[model samples]
Target chain A: MSAPGSALIEARGVSVRLDGRGILTGIDLDVRAGEILALVGPNGAGKSTLLSVLSGDASPNEGEVTLLGRPIGDYRALELARLRSVLTQANAVSFPFRVIEIVQMGRNPWMRGSTVDDDREAVIRAVEAADVEHLLGRRFTSLSGGEQARVSLARVLAQSTDIVFLDEPTAALDLRHQEEVMRVARGLAAQGRAVVVVVHDLSLAGAYADRIALLDSGRLDALGTPAEVMTAERVSRVYGLEVRIHRLGASGRPVVLPLRD
Target chain B: MSPRIRAVGLTLLLAGVVVGGIVLSAITGQLAITPTEVAGSLLRAVGLDTVWAPTDPIVESTLWFVRFPRILMGLLVGAALAVAGAVMQAIFGNPLAEPGVVGVSSGAALGAATAIVLGASVLGGAGIAVFAFLGALLATLLVYVVSRAGGRTEVVTLLLTGIAINAFAQAGIAFVLFVADTASREQIVFWQLGSIAGSLWSQVAIVAAVGVAGVIAAILLAQRLDLLALGERNARHLGVNVERLRLVSIVLVALLTGVAVAFTGIIAFVGLVVPHIIRMIIGPAHRGLIIASAVGGGALLVLADLLTRTMVAGAELPIGMLTSLIGGPFFFYLLWRQRRRSGGWA
Candidate 1:
């Protein structure tokens, strides 16, 4: 068990170049346990790439990512799978597998371990958490885009890993489901898990994430609480749009709105 | 019916059909033996003395030396091809993928043809089998490498790659036929058409060994294959070694299809049609799908072989031709359905 507020995964000066173009450069970040870390950026800003590098899906050209005090590359696929789960942007299933079957697949990494007995309980809890119990019998391919996103989240949740990476998980979701997904992420963090999410919607990230990391041109532009990073000047300058920030409700969550001249 | 019940019912139904087909195939030829006589002879061969065992030498010899080996060959080859098809579909993540459609059978056929033409007899009786395995391996690797762009295999690209490989393999076979002697030319042509007319026990033993082993290996891979259907990256995230699984499955497909083709020649579409239909009946949970496919494929070929022998008066039609006649239209139907759904040749 990792101590709360300690880094579950730490990246040191990570740099990635693909096709001779830099996707990420000299980035340092830590995904600490018991918090939601949102990677917020404009399109083509390498939010997903940074998430990929941190999740072990992509290796950096320079620097290192360490998970659980060991280099990410040192872990085998199954070992990494047991330690972390990733929900990619696209949720396409080639065959007509049912939703329940897809969720059950999340237990694969645990199958070879003593935690095998927890599979059914884990799947049931995940299905409830993502509110996908109703869609269990339906074919994955037959679901709507929003429904697919939730079901994919259920699969990620069912993996029961300490660290989770969700890349634009709410992109195809409705407003209600988007909030539900963030609440689920919060619930995971409440249970001492580390969550790293990429969000295109700045306001949603401000409302839910404990700390926000703003990326601009593959560099870490800002890293702090929503109020500290969601300033009008930085948001407008990075996104190339004049944006107004408003503190809302008792929690004073920053809400970013594009300024209309 | 519940899925579990349906799966169980389908398994029982396929087993019955395979057993019935085997018994029917054994007794339906020119031999005037009864089912009881076939049973008794089988029993007696296993050291049971039964009164119903045929006293006539001709009937006994025909049953053991002729019909039994042919029937066993059909069963083994059918199971092999269908399981190979299931494995191919799993690896490629496309239902349209098949050994015959993807040119694996033709490649093996070309290898066997070359072996026949070059008089590879000095390498022992298994020379054609070895060459066929090599040819199928090369074709499988070639198709896999060329058809995949990025990580996924697009249906159009896979089918087009199949077409290109099929054309190349057919030309190679033609060249082998052209250079062969008059006697070897007849053998090559006959082998290309595919049949089990003169199957021997030794050949049956080889196909049986390879086919059974391949099916077991495929069943072991069933769970990973189900994960693979979620796409390559997703499968990798779930702990499946996608590249290693693809490699092992490709070799398994080549070994099974190669040995089957080495004996029965290019028997078309058993792989495609059988596994697809089994998947439809049982859903795509590969363990059940593959087992049912092996049984269903064996039953289908046994019955088809029976039809080939008796469809015309004393004329044996090529079993491969009969299968293509049916499977070709089924493939078209599948393509049409996929087109209507995806709204293009995606």
Candidate 2:
């Protein structure tokens, strides 16, 4: 249902400079409605920096960022908060809060009334969608790391925003939860929302993302369909690792199978 | 115990303590009024009549003048300190955090001391309150800014900055004490020892008002505190205006700390000790911890003050001494308990 050529977000020549050093420079990117973009990069590739700018959590040193056709800075806090949500790689949570209670925090952007039924409904749906409904009543911090990740996923699912920014959202998860997160992000894209994820896992990104944007040394190395962008040559060049790209049957999606040296 | 059962048990015990503490505090004193007499006196004072007749004028005077204000101030101070303490802990993200432990109380005390010694008589009634508030605000802002100099402000950095500021401020106060005249010395002494002595009705009224406002604000912000418990980055991702939340909460806690320190002087430990106790009862959820600690802290302080007054005859010890006596051991006990549980403090 995505409108043809309707850009959900547009960043033009966006550059980020922090602490007397340039973290990202000469970056231009766009994502259309209903597309899942994987920001793939090695460490220190400015994937987090670019995600930070797009989610309105950080600003570009030069040029500009626009979300949903509006300048990032011009959007009111509530407006910006309502339109997008971010899930960073690491979270330091303390003490135990009921899973449902933790998930209800996603409603902070829209809650005007005290009645939390709608919020709870959203949480329930998110938890069910994330396959963590069994852990809804459990304490969040008490859960395993993988379980906490799923609960946090339920939280953003409850956020139910048009654009979701995930900065290495599955970095702490095991293999199964990593797949679950990719599946969820892809599902969100299928529902006509834009999902941008920063990932180190070449295989996961290749499997789920409609397009892969490879970042190297804070610059865009490649940005195109998974088939076009992900090749053994590019992977080895960017990540300094021997990697083979297996073109999976039918979908024509490139499955990255790294050839260890 | 499971979290749910522990929560329920703590809630009941805290309520019992508060109710029992308030009733006992209000009803008993050196004058030895019966429960009926206390009830009747309160009823008539508030324009509600029961079967009991009016007590003697002197006893009535005692009720209206001494006991009532004392109890109210205790409740205000305890509640204010606890709220401020909880906010500090949340902002600093350390369970050991306290309003005074971070220099907020002493800073307010220094401002109040300066106001009195300099006779900033123009401020008159509001003089001490304003000075205390300013001092607290300055200290809080200083700690926050100093800790942020390197583009990062974490819990450990903020706590250490607080320690450094507190040490420097105390050293300055000592210099002031060394150079002061007798009258100023006595006043500073009283302030340092922290007495609720000479708590006039108006003063009590101010403390109550500010304390209530502070506690209410904290309670309303309980959700943000909970989100914040997840840390700054996590909080921002959840749509919390991380900087704004930090700024507002720090300012609010400073205001409450200043007001509490202004009138009550440098009462210690209630803020730090009480909330930790409450968290042990209610678990770490700030939503429940803030409100429960407010009520529980208020009750504890009022009761402690009542003990301070009646603990000895013909002489009133500084309330600071009393709370320190209690808090110092409680602090050590927490250390010991933590040692036993985890083998060492983090």
Candidate 3:
């Protein structure tokens, strides 16, 4: 409804091939700042692959990607690192690093000649923002799945990048923690950064994303607001399951439920 | 304590221990020179006027020609192995990875074997050193190239590749020994067992130059290595050139490993254990880990060499055997404790 915000990232006719197998094909998308774009799809639908290409984690075999009007491949690693940060689904640290130490790693890009005082302050602020200050002294390997996820989020937040790509950041969290994580994403978007979240939960996507891009077999099946994309017919057709879209009266958010024959 | 202060303190402490180990190693032998006199002789030999110097020609020659070169070799080899281990662990993202265990040292051994048995020469005097470095770099590159898939390397792949390469290199060494004359065969066996017993000043000088350069390069790459531990995808996102980092790190690891192995033979556990011990004390920050591992490794080898020399009367143990005998148990302890704490392999 609001005029689309300025495009921060543009992918034109992008495709990815690995080991002679095509993983993503002809995906043209514009990710705009001040918006949360949720990529939702079934397993093996290439949502993660698309996110990787957008975040410069994987190079596309065909087509072009530009971030902030420059080809993604043209930017230096350090320069690109200052502009984007990615939170991968798996965060396994081999060493027993402290939680604060893990979060401090986020400041690595800015640590060139930066004082220790500045680093400590940035780490503390990121910890508070991610609400993981209580776990600061704890070893990362000692933390629970949810706690580690939050600490990892804090690490990404410490990067202070403009474009954030989070791949299933709430996959290990409880309902409350899930909401907390999604709230952080929304808050980041509100601060004028483009946030792309790859998630399996349609309800969370519906609640937080300004637009949902439904992917099926490496193609964009549908892309729009919840009401425009989450109709029972399209949901059933895309997911291959009968479903009902229930609208929450107060917030008018669509919730999808599978219907029995 | 602040990490900066802690790092500085740890560096100073390790430096003191290394110096102490060198002095202890220098004085305690069959001839039995006094520790204070040994120090004075060393300082005086280096043109520094000291309060005490060995007046006897035998003592002076013993200090400079015999003990000093061997001790210096031990120090350089120890430092090189440990620094290489730290860099390998960081690059491979595994605590257990090391040059000897991962076949890089054996690759160097094979190259050195070719030079010794086949009489290959590349740089006249530095022939063996050049071949060993080339062999080490090639072997590591082979393992890395084989393990990497889709722009990422898996630790399991690295372990597996290392095992295969190590076995292959062992067979190659065995073949070389089989083809050698009786005297050459004995020399090859002694070399394989790894001892600094016959260290020369020329050998010490070569290891020192190469080892110092490799160690310094590893230290400089420390920050990038820390970023790389975040996984390749995440590291790339954070503006690290993952491919470049991996390439440079492997080359440096090979250079360090090759130089140490060329001089000392296949000293296994120093590279594997020293870094792990330092990580336990100082945590896994490579910036500090690299420096501490260098000093700690040097001290450890000096101590090991001392053990080899003194543990038996008139007959010294092979340095490699002593390291493995000590390092194997220490590795198991670390593994068991880690399993108990994490309840899984990290």
**TM-scores of the models, in the order given:** 0.98, 0.92, 0.93
lDDT tens per residue, model 1, B43-62:
99999989989998888999
Which 10 successive residues of model 1 chain B have the least lDDT summed? Answer: B120-129
Judging by lDDT against the true structure, name the best candidate: 1
List, residue by residue over B121-182, the lDDT tens digit for candidate 2: 25554788888888888888877677653223444565687788788778867776777778
Could you give candidate 1's per-residue lDDT for residues A225-244 as a string of tens digits? 99899999999999999999
Q: Positional deviation of A130 in candidate 3, in angstroms? A: 1.5
Worst 10 residues of 2 chain A by lDDT: A88-97
Total residue pair clashes for candidate 1: 0
The most accurate candidate by TM-score is 1
Tens-place lDDT digits, model 3, residues B38-123: 87887887899777887888998988888989988998999999999889888777777788877899999998877777665434
Q: In what order do the candidates fall by lDDT, top score first? A: 1, 3, 2
DockQ sort, best first:
1, 3, 2
- TM-score comparison, 1 vs 2, better candidate: 1
Q: Score candidate 1 by TM-score against the native.
A: 0.98
Superposed by TM-score, candidate 3 places the C-alpha of residue A23 at a distance from the truth, in angstroms, of: 3.9
Give lDDT: candidate 2, residue A117.
80
Residues A1-261, candidate 2, lDDT per residue (tens digit)? 457347878999989988978889899999777889999899988999999888887889898898777888887666776788877666546556678777877887777753578777777788887888788777786788778777777777888788888878788788888888898898888888889999888888988998899999989999999999998888899989888889887988888877865
